[model samples]
Target: MQRYFVTPAGLTETEVVLEGDDARHLATVMRAKAGDPFVACDGEGTEYVAEAAEVSPGRVVGRIVQRRASASEMRWRVTVAQSLPKGDKLETVIQKGTEAGAYAFQPFLSRRTVVQYDDRKEAKRVERWRKIAKEAAEQAHRGRVPEVGAVASWKALLAGFAEYDAVWLCYEEEGRAGVGLKPVLRAFGSSLGEGETPNLLLVVGPEGGFAPEEAEQAIAAGAACVGLGRRILRTETAALVALAAIGYESGEMGG
Candidate 1:
């Protein structure tokens, strides 16, 4: 069944409405008729099994058949604080990272970041990134879409470190030293109190990687410098590797 993330306005007490692209996909592309079934999510963790009741050119309404809990959300929330890389790599990160169960994304500027920060055009980029997250969430059957935040500076990024229970800096230097990610995650998990779900932050560098001073500042701000493995990864690949490792460790992936 196809799934969609709907707003409050799109859902009602007994029916669900899909507009624009979703509507066209259902009505024209799928050629759905009355009684065709599909899944609907409110993007607040609630899901419904619904059947098409009314299908039109640009709109489709469905009657709710069953409501149930969404089982796809990860128990531990992981936020990726990525330094801006060149071109459209950030878009790939957000899309694949959402599929990999990232709770949110924060793009920041590191000392070695190459992209010129433009405050004027940032809002549009953020909006597009958010849309990518939404579409990715639906495709992955995620209960909710990951949030895409506006770009922040180095200082601003470190100041928000207090919010997470644990922060890891994915550094190639650590990778070369063979400091594995698994052991660090296991240690961090063991230190948490019983029944505590941790909010984790993974800080990744840009194409040129982090400056030595920037890494020092991050370590001072309660971040533990960790490595993915001996093999160095692209800035976009590091977070996904970390997220997959976390999923396996947390039992979300079949061990």
Candidate 2:
């Protein structure tokens, strides 16, 4: 069934009111009629199986059939902190990362970053990235949309390290030294207490990767410097690989 993320106001005791783009998509694109089934999520973990009750111009109302639990989210809330890469590589990361179970995306400007940070275009760009995440989340059957944070400065990124339970910085130097992600994740996983849901931050630098000092600062701020493997991954690829590793290690990928 098609899934739609509706706001709390859009969901009531008995109905789901999809408005704007979702309404248009259901009415025109999907050609949904009364009784057509779909799934609705409130983006706060509550989900419902519903059928179309009314379809009109710019509005589609769905009658709630039953509430269902969606086990699509990873046990760990892993946020990807990516340094702004040139071109549309960030878009690819956000899309693929969402499908791979990233809880959120945090874009930051690093020292080696070549793309100039433009404050004027920041809002529009972030908005587009969020839309990409939303579409990807829906396609991935995720109950909640991944958050796309505004680009942060290097210092700001480091300062925010305290917010997460653990931070892993993807460093090529570590990869060259033969340090792999598995052992680090294993150790971290072992440290978790019963019923604990860890907030993991995976940091990946830009095309040139992080500057020596940048990595040093992150480490000092409590981030664990880790490698994906012997082969260094592109900035865009690192986060997705890490997310997959997290899911597999957490048993979300199955035995």
Candidate 3:
């Protein structure tokens, strides 16, 4: 069954109306017709087993058959604070990172950042990133699309360290100390508030990586510097690797 994320406007008391791109995918690409069964998700973690009730050139209406909880989302919330990488690598990061169960993405300007988005063009870039995330989540059967946040400076990124249960800075030099991500996660678990779900933020540097002074400032802001094993991963690959590491530690993989 195909699944489409329904915005509030597309949802009604007992039916969903998918428009634009979703409608084209269903009505034209899928060749859907009345009574054809599919799935619909509301981005609020709700899924409906539905059947197509109406189909037009650019619209797909489906009647809800059954409702159920979305089990695809990770139990532990993970956000990737990625330093802007060159070219379209960030698009790849958002796509696969969402598949790997990252709940949000924050692209920040690092000391070594090579690309700069002017304020006049930043909104357009953010909009494009969000669309990429949405399509990726749907393809991966994710319950909700991971949010693509606006760009921020290095200092602005460090200011929110206390908001998460744990923050890990993926540094190339951290491997020398033999500090593993698993132990860092365990330590964070021990300190989390009762009844509160553990939340983690992984900070990945750009192509040239973070400057030493920036890493020091991040450490002082309550982020633990952790190694993603001994290999020097690319800026894009590092975030997904870190996410997988934490997911494995949480026992959420290989079930």
Report the lDDT tens digits of candidate 1 across residue range 129-212.
Answer: 999999999999999989999999999999999999999999889889888788998887778776577899999999988888
| Model 3, runs deviating above 4 Å | 190-196
Residue pairs with backbone atoms closer than 3 Å in model 1 (clashes): none
Give the per-residue lDDT digits (tens) of candidate 3, residues 124-211.
9999999999999999898998999999888888998899877899998887667778788777666666546677889999999889
Query: Global lDDT for candidate 1?
Result: 0.92
Pick by lDDT: 1 or 3, better one: 1
- What candidate 1 gets wrong by more than 4 Å, as runs, is 193-195
Computed on alpha carbons, the lDDT of every model, listed in order, comes to 0.92, 0.92, 0.88
Model 2: lowest-lDDT 10 consecutive positions: 38-47
- Candidate 3 achieves a global lDDT of 0.88
Query: Could you tell me how far off, in angstroms, the CA of residue 245 lies in candidate 1 after the best superposition?
Result: 0.7
TM per model?
A: 0.96, 0.98, 0.95
Considering summed lDDT, which 10 consecutive residues are worst modelled in model 3? Answer: 188-197
The TM-score of candidate 2 is: 0.98
